[model samples]
Target: MTYTHASPEHGAPERADDVDDVARILQPDGTRVSDPALDRWISDLPPHELRALHRDMVLTRRLDTEGVALQRQGQLALWAPCRGQEAVQVATAHALAAGDLVFPSYREHGVLLARGARPADFVLAWRGEEHSAYDHAALGVAPVQIIIGAQALHATGWAMGAQRDRSTDVAVAYFGDGATSQGDVNEAMVFASSFRAPVVFVCSNNQWAISEPVTVQARHPIAGRAPGFGIPSMRVDGNDALACLAAMRWALDHARRGEGPAFIEAVTYRLGPHTTSDDPTRYRDADEVERWSRRDPLARLEAYLRDAGVLDDSGLAEVARAADAFAAEVRAACIGAVTRDPASVFDHVYAEPHAPLERQRAEYVDYLDGFSR
Candidate 1:
């Protein structure tokens, strides 16, 4: 249901700040713009950590590129490309602790990579061999949610439990710009605020949610919606990895400290088509794409690393080689994935063995056996 008017008790629809002026710590050219006194708190990450983030970003892109290729080659049913939002996903993902949980929207390839989801896990699922490539317990992440914004409620409920346990762990809900319009997301925020759930609503506002631009959905910034829920909200340049990492760290810290939920709207662009089947060129202008291309997160971070002398030409060469190798490995896995038996799809439909499900599984078995005969 579209929320035309929130309750008056929420207070005159709390005035929204100009989100275009939201705080940002990193420039497109890798220049720092954060407060001088809080330099260490913001961008003074350990050298090794920073280096690792860069590599992970590159690897994420390589996986994304290969995933698209696999889909085009008919190895996978469909693919959601995360081409332009790598920095947002990688930085926010790395900010979480090992025990924290993540509920990702379907296109969270970068987050899945940061959470240690291998190429095999992704390919096997896309190849229709399994329900998902990830094991929740091992990865500390839930299965990808395709039913838009449903995971927000899950995250909120999980965060309530975490809060009761008095644990520092937090629950993160990752969704796209379009999710804000979902009733599930709004209801989740309402419950989270009322109960002070320890969750962070991380919205990757990549400008376009499929064919609909963000402007078509909301009149104000998505972040502004949180204020009405009594949750602290902020916007970050999603293309700036450094800014995203710092913002996520701060938001996680707030939730971990029992300060209730936080909301982050990451401003980014989607460089590729929404999915393998969607054509973005029909609705989007070429000039807009070109403008955002100049702000490519990887190139920005690459410039920063080179400018700061953190990486030399040889180091850059190694990164390129590593990306290529990683892509090849993913391609091999996708091609080698085995098809799952059709009956297996019904194996876990009912936890306690519902009679109807059993009948269906049996019928499926009989159907497959007939094909063999």
Candidate 2:
């Protein structure tokens, strides 16, 4: 099987690089900033919608934490954490309509959760039960593509087909900083730009490609790379929920209007190891972690909510209780998940039976029967 890691993807070299300012919609203090257009966008949202965004962020973070804990405890063989990057996933997901499909990297639990995927189903893949517990067609999401940067190609192709179908549906590809270095990503951007495909590429630049620093991949910000490919791009504070949501809205609109692909680089930090398999202490320093903690999206949004009268102490408590309960249910489901049947391995491989597969299955069954249960 192919190894998958958490990340968020890139193309064009014929055009001049026009990347400059990264748009910001929410200040660190929760105050609105940046373009008046973005300000108006947020103003148009109901207060309840704003609160729901915060709620999604909090719960998604909780799910990330739970997944990490389960992995550490040996409940999961491995896991890719989305801990510090909740706002990037959650806020962007909130901006998508039900019909808009997402081609996500392996670490998009926040996006799936915001799209109403069951918490238990989210953990099923990491638990090694099956490839995916969630249905792709039903959820308007593809299976979390484990091959780095492959989803970009898938999204671009999907967008091309959607355009032909005269469908309003948009396709999104989410990957990490490292994926920008991959050729598949660059090629995907080229196709999307050439076809004017309704695709949006989101790069969650958490500053680490596994253990390597993102600085090693590019000296300039990742967003800057998109302009060279003839794609308009935006960079935003990934930890800022409002900024993430606003940027996504801007990109979605541009793409839906058949303006072609848009790229967003959400600058943030991954507060945890790249995966449960990684030892971050060997690479990242404690000071760096602490620095990111101060900018924790959850805390920033919470402070904003309290000051803006969107949430009070009681409201916060309710969010906490709900998240905790949901997390527990996820844990229980993981623990109680049925073990994969060895015989079932032959299933889902092909739509039809073949001689080789049948022979292999027969041999496997015979071998199994020879053993004492």
Candidate 3:
């Protein structure tokens, strides 16, 4: 029932050929490892908070499962599973302050869940009902960006604005390893470096990007790319919840103290396909998936908590019941969802009405009237 995760020994170089150049604080078998450098960030976390972390991961997995099911059952257009990246998403979100902002790629369901996204918020866009169901300013999370790596620039720009106003808020961008290869991601790093903006670039280096493996994107560690941009970066075992929490805390502290942006390459695996539209069997080996499954983020954290006396059999059952209830709520919300008026698509295309846009809207209305005739 415990995990035996591979934790790198100390003194490994940051830029290396393999993922061994990573930091970890928990072993796969539920044993706690020591990392003097990173321990301070999470040393004071109370038992209740630790238990909460476990619950968050559990709920996130359930949400992911329900989302995939919804898509399969025809309630959603598509879904992106976070089967193995729960620890990274939940831990990083917990590290954020109320004023901090999140700019996430479309797959960051756990992050949005941790940030209090409602079930309807999660399904609105996937159901083709709205641009984004959640309120961006209110949640402090920007609308999901389907365009790969674009959120990096958005986060950097938001950070720059915060800097100009002398606000203490920081912004974090979440993207996959494939996004690191995109021009927008590279350009965002350049601007963030030049301006010393208070932003954190978090790359969940889930080994595959659609049909391509991580090897196709970078010969070296993704963490290595940030230092060249004059930013400090770290690679952490993404399956280790404690390690991820510690790493994010350190990065957030660095940004909050007026230092330049930092980067985190959370070495994780994509246990599922890239999205509901993808098929891993086409390019991924079954044995490889089996290997990564042994390092399941939820199981790893559950083992750790059980050993630490923070969770028992009853506690585990309670968490499961909560997850089931949450999933059911999400399902009901999606099933009962209502679509918006077709004309509403043009409502927010511009901040104010324009003559040409109004004309286009009128034309569209006339086109719709043709159906009646």
Candidate 1 wrongly placed segments (more than 4 Å): 1-20, 36-40, 350-354, 370-373
TM-score of each: 0.92, 0.92, 0.95
Candidate 1 residue 169 C-alpha distance from true site, Å: 1.1
Could you tell me which residue pairs clash in candidate 1? Answer: none
Cα lDDT tens digits, model 3, 96-208, are 99999999999998899889888788898999999888998888999999999999999999999999999989999999999999999999999999999999999999988
For model 1, state the Cα shift of residue 39 in Å: 4.2
TM-score of candidate 2 versus the correct structure, residues matched by position: 0.92
| Candidate 2 vs 3: which has more TM-score | 3
Candidate 2 deviant stretches above 4 angstroms: 1-21, 369-373
lDDT of each: 0.84, 0.85, 0.88
lDDT of 1 at 44: 60
The superposed Cα distance between candidate 1 and the true structure at residue 45, in angstroms, equals: 0.7
**Which candidate number maximizes TM-score?**
3
Instruction: Give the lowest summed-lDDT range of ten residues in model 3.
Output: 1-10
RMSD of candidates 1 onward, in order = 4.6, 6.0, 3.9
Best-fitting candidate, scored by lDDT: 3
